[model samples]
Target: MNPRNRNILIAAIVVIVVVVAGIIGVTSHKKSSANSKTVNIGIMTSTKQDDAIWKVVSKTAKDKYGITLKFTHFTDYTQPNKALQNGSIDLDAFQHYAFLNEWNQANKTDLVSIGDTMISPIHIYSSKYKDVKDIPDNATVAVPNDASNESRALYVLKSAGLIKLDVSGDALATPKDVTENPKHLVIKELDAAQTARALDSVAASVVNFNYATAAKLPENQSIYAEPINKDSAQWINLIAAKKSEKNNKIYKEVVKAYETAATKKAIKEQYPTGGELPAWGLKLK
Candidate 1:
């Protein structure tokens, strides 16, 4: 073998090695970029406000972390968690801790909350009476038939001095726990979505903010609305995902976006009377 030919062969081998290494590097980088790209989120509804919030989050995610975000809104609460559990959604932001807990317990799923979003204050509205004291003895009060919100209604009634509950601490309380009914408030449990409409028939009703908002009955119009500082286990609305996805980068970014000043400002502006207070905490303690 001649010296020139040997040298050319060695140079050719080096070039080939470099080219292969470059190809491998490029492939790996592309895969990494693809994996770290857009995050798909599931929300309750695809309204204008939800789109606006998603835009803010998408911008933040892209600007801060070079990630894009997509939002998917479900019309019902049951499907979002089911979607999360089934790995259809990366995360969800429409439910409170109580609903999540109840679903988890009932379905034996491992969905967990990653961060707090905003508290949807429950309100007790009445047309026949101005306050709790005005209700006649044994007055029928309509409450959401759902477990969590029904429990919340009972707590509100207890708070209003209409009933005495046997439960202690800030855990979820049910109607069965009512030890004393000074007003003899007959709890006429109705579907949560229907509680707002029941206001016309019942003496008073405990209404969720969403239904209340839908009914055009803001919190200010209610006879009583839950206060901001009340941490009575019912106020902890949260951002949730499957347990396996809890610590993902996208989840953290979503949490950051949710906790941002802009998000809080939007919440206050959007739901001033509904008492949509912030809850930055995610983990249960």
Candidate 2:
């Protein structure tokens, strides 16, 4: 072959090699992007109640977002938050805002709320009396020992006129803030999970709805239950994730599943009479 012809053939081969390399690079990039989009969600427990809700989330994620959900359940509250902070999980949905805020503030972590979930109303259950006023003056009452829940128990007591708190507006009231006790009620603080059992010992006890339900306490039998339409800031449960995952597509899909009509139907069928009200937003009405 002539020298010019040989040089042209060499150049054509180089151009072909460059085109093949570009196609391979584009294909690799597409696969990498797709792999990075799968979402890993962490829940607190695999309890029967939670499993019911998660089924909806899982189905919605597969059908709507074309994303696979890797669901994990922590046995306790601490591990899920730690896992989320360390990037082990992308999102978590087993705690209320009060618990999340308390944990984040104490640990100095940057967990944020992406959306609200359901509100499990804490009820004041009485074994000895028919109503709040029926309890004798100076009788003992049981409340949760944790800071956030303790404050909520105190507020419930204040609402029932068993104690008076120096709270302005709708602020949370604490034991130290108790301004007056016309009944001089003896307050016995116990672990939140243990409060339901304290009913046999104390005049009455403030119990979180989950524990109450687990203990088989009938919802209609409670002496006092939080109103579903109160719009109280303290009532909203949240979907929490690291600040980095706030706008993630899979995280948004989980929130959407939580607020779907199917979720509302599940909640209503499971908790008729507003025992566990849907709280996806601030306005309950």
Candidate 3:
């Protein structure tokens, strides 16, 4: 063979070998990646912006444990658990013990709490009155009409000296349950989601913290907010998974990633008042 022709043939062979080796390396990396686990979880936050913490949590979980996280966001409270139960997602990080307990009883599902999140308290806000005492005796106060928060709002009002309940310390008090109206106060019932926006129409309205964030109501404007530790364990929000997944290692890492200080700050920044008390360090008992 001619010397130049032989040299050209050798170069072609070397090129083919290099290309095949590169393809094998790429294929191996993809196979290794595909072998790792990815977790899909649902969260019902106030809005998409409030879903920011999942980004940080996802990054950390992926880096530390070769885990991939897919977050499904929900603005509605009733949807997360349904999505979880139907296998739309593997887990969810929404609702507290009381809400979950009620949901499980009503739906006959065995969902359970895996870990705690922060407690976002219910608050009463007044556009007209700064001090609860300064309000007119008969001033209309708005409360959430839903059974759960209506009771909570009444207790908040009772604690503020605004009204007296038939059961003074009842956690499930309703308007009819008000035994005494010293000021002849008319309790206006509105949808739970609307209570924050109804401030201009009523003397004051009790707002859920999530709805308060949605309405952009500053926490400073609150006439009263439920104290963090004062509230029962029923009020403590949590990360939930199927009772079947209680021992899931990946799901546990997802909770660990979310409970970090960085994720706590992320939760706080989503609200105007820097958010509620962190329940990360709290025990289940």
Candidate 4:
């Protein structure tokens, strides 16, 4: 063979080798990705209730995003964030922006919101009074004692025309912030879970929607509910991950799964009577 022909042959062999190598690399990448498809998420609610919404989300993630969602259930509000911080779970979806802020400030952790989920509105429920107007002076009104929730409950009271607050809408207001109580309302604070239970004893109690659902609080008993207005944006529920994973592609896909039409339908069905409103892309004004 001539030198020129020999050189051409070598060049052809090099081209075939590079093409074959590229195909193998692509196949290997797919396999590696498939192995990492399953992601574990932490939740602090009853699995039965969440399953209604997450069943749709999980199915969507699997079908459309090639991801599998597994849940790690915690019994209380405090555990999921701790679990996420410790790398025990890949994500958490049981908190609003205010609650997350409170937790992050207290724990000094850098968890950040990656997606909005829903607004679990807090309402003043009364077993005795037919309306907020009917509740007399010196009536005891129970509110959640937690920093964020206490502030939200006060805002709800202000909305009801039962009290006046001195703090800004976003401030973590307390009983001291109650600048005026025209009804001379007694602001009793209790655990968020116990607020619903307090309705029987107190004139009224500000109850988180989840606790109200768990307590089976009657719809008509809710005399006043906080508006889902611009100020309520901080109360919008969200999915949170570690700051390091805030921009993670798989995490973003999980958010996409939760924001689908099917998930919205499931949320409505699961939380009949508007206990939980889907908040993704909600234009609060």
Query: Which structure among the candidates has the greatest lDDT?
Result: 4
The residue pairs in collision within model 1 are: none
Angstrom error of the Cα, residue 47, model 1: value is 4.1
lDDT of 2 by residue, 62-179 (tens): 7877767788778776798898899888887778767777887899998998988888778899877888888888888999998778878887787676787786664456777898
2 or 4: which has the higher TM-score? 4
How does each model score on TM-score? 0.84, 0.85, 0.77, 0.87
lDDT of 3 at 132: 81
Model 4 / residue 80 / CA error / Å: 0.8
Task: Using TM-score, give the best candidate's number.
Answer: 4
**Between candidates 3 and 4, the lDDT winner:** 4
Residue 120 displacement in candidate 2 (angstroms): 0.6
lDDT string, candidate 1, 72-107, tens digits: 778987888888788787887788877888888899
Q: Which residue pairs in model 4 clash with each other?
A: none
lDDT of model 4, residue 52: 79
TM-score of structure candidate 3 = 0.77
Model 1 residue runs over 4 Å out of place are 1-35, 168-171, 218-220, 229-231, 281-285
What lDDT tens digits, residue by residue, belong to model 4 across residues 17-40? 999999999999998987678889
What TM-score would candidate 4 get against the native? 0.87
Candidate 3 lDDT over residue span 69-155, tens digit each? 887888888999999999899888778776788788889999999888777778789888888887787888888886767777887
Candidate 1, residue 240: CA error in Å? 1.1
